[model samples]
Target: MTDSRIAAESWETLRARHSAKWRRYPADVIPMHVAEMDYPVAAPIRAALGELVASSDMGYLGPMPEIAPAFTAFAESRWGWTPDTSNARLAPDVGVATVEFLRAHNVSRVIVTSPVYAGFWHWLEELGIDIVDVPLTSDFRLDISGIEREFANGVGHLLLCNPHNPLGRVFGRDELLALAEAADRHNAVVIADEIHAPLTYPGSDFVPYLSLGPAAERTGVLVTSTSKSWNLAGLKAAFILGHGDRGTELLKPLPEAMHWRSSILGAFSMSVAYRDGVEWLDSTLDTLAVARDHLASELKRLLPSAHLEMVPEAGYLAWVDVSGLNLGDRPWDRILEEARVSVVPGTELGPQYTQHIRINFATSPELITRALTQIAAL
Candidate 1:
């Protein structure tokens, strides 16, 4: 593969590409792959979460210690939209929080924009809810008219993904407002997954679903966690934000303990991350920004036949147009066997995305180089 400017750059960029190489490698084989990064934890996060774990303090924790503040602080500091911390509640994960919210709302049939995280269906099935699939257009965005058709048939809930995964398309405010209007029309509660909001590209704006306007009070939105930005996925802590009476009413179906799974260290980490993580997050995002550029350049250099798709301003994950590659049944498996790289397949997300691949570019420079080299050879 052609060389790029990974060196003579930021530590985040250098570390990301290098770490992946070492992590999935034999002594000699490099790994410019995987979503996991090679960089060490930010000092504040390392210090805060480390202090508790070092003390062997693992136990059940209470609700997120000002998770709303942690998140809203990021929002206000970055997006200028102030999310009320008071509405924040805790859940083990975003997917869990979503289904739990739906359960409470007595929603048996939920509608989701297709080719999402893919696991949304797993969660829906686990919760025994039927799904309404609204596939995105060829452009990887909502087929708004199709959604309305589904709404006409009836939808009890709507799941929204801001800065949607794989494709990294951050919905515009007007787009979100239109979605909210549809859910409202169907009498469906809107459950949004804004987990990747923090990593939003530099210029793209993230529009919160519930924060839409007066009509949003009746809409149920669940914003949670800093896992994507801070690289804290294993921490298993996330918060759900709801509005007014509508928020409270959605919880009538579940027992109180369903909301009690928030772990102590996770909550502590969320607080510490929010309170002292501004610089680290900025730096980490800076690293991700580098990864994005690296991936873009490498894609052009190596896989010009592939559709790089629309990579919104933010995010390290890429939605590649592997359709031109034409690998069938299991493109991810094919890439792994041919290239020895593990990537998330689009098939899991939906049939429309079968030839697509979602690559996590959060690794080290060497790893990125090597991963691209392998793909170029393929």
Candidate 2:
């Protein structure tokens, strides 16, 4: 209820904004679809960008030596692990970093756990890489045996999402170690998209893939950004970190332009965010925690049959199974039409998830209540 660092703007104010989340829907619809947050940017990141523009330093990105050290410090403080900053390389975003890394490694086929981030499918399809979908377990945990089976079948690449997007399940260290061992045994590469790692809740442990020791270092590649955690996607910058020499060798095939193509503003903003934005980040997490719980409670009270199987362990997304609502196969579409609240169709995340929907609950509890109330009325 404190509005100091994490307050979302008024509906009128958010409606005036030009972002896709606001613009994609008409005034009649409440958009609970996009992953972007409604909160203001952290003060440190805003000040840094303001200073850059005031100084007219709008030139192309140059040496961002600060990035490595800032990221190292943040990683150490948050996760008790220090990455090999020497192998940290910049890209325009996580999508570009993932695509470029897979392309550089000549990866023709990759294993993806579903229902996962929709972008994972798009990124792989763009490269014409064969996708092997190994769905998560019934409880939405990693299907390790299924993944191992795929690896044994000669799938040499795995695209992982930790603090996973739609479901918000943070992969534990034990699970990651098992995965690392499997990848090592099969000489497979694991590219982890850990963009949401920093948003993990207090009780859940988010293990960075590269922090799993020798096997992970040998077979793991990490792609992350300040975009998801700090809400800086528009700034357009992300980094890939490798474990050591082997990690470095794995990334060697990426083109030099990958570094320069990044926005200078994005690069420095990320550095500032990592180094100085922890206070704001923590406050925002607290706010999101409340919002997440509010969404769950409202769902239970207003729509008792809707299933939020797991109270999300990280991020603002809530994946609900609405099959019990009996709204038919494409419930998201029906909800949009009847409730006038737009949410992500679960089928987009994976083919088999037709009766589910993903809601963005990073706003006020009032807004969450309103959205759910409207759905309940339906």
Candidate 2 local lDDT, 42-75, one digit each (tens) = 9989999999999999899999998889999999
Query: For every model in order, what is the number of clashing pairs?
Result: 15, 0
> For residues 11-76, could you state the per-residue lDDT of candidate 1 as single tens digits?
445434434434454433333334445555667878977788889877677545566666667777
Looking at candidate 1, the ten consecutive residues that score lowest on lDDT are 1-10
State residue 348's C-alpha deviation in candidate 2, in Å. 1.1
What is residue 265's positional error in candidate 2, in angstroms?
1.1
- The top-ranked prediction according to TM-score is 2
User: What's model 1's overall lDDT?
Assistant: 0.70
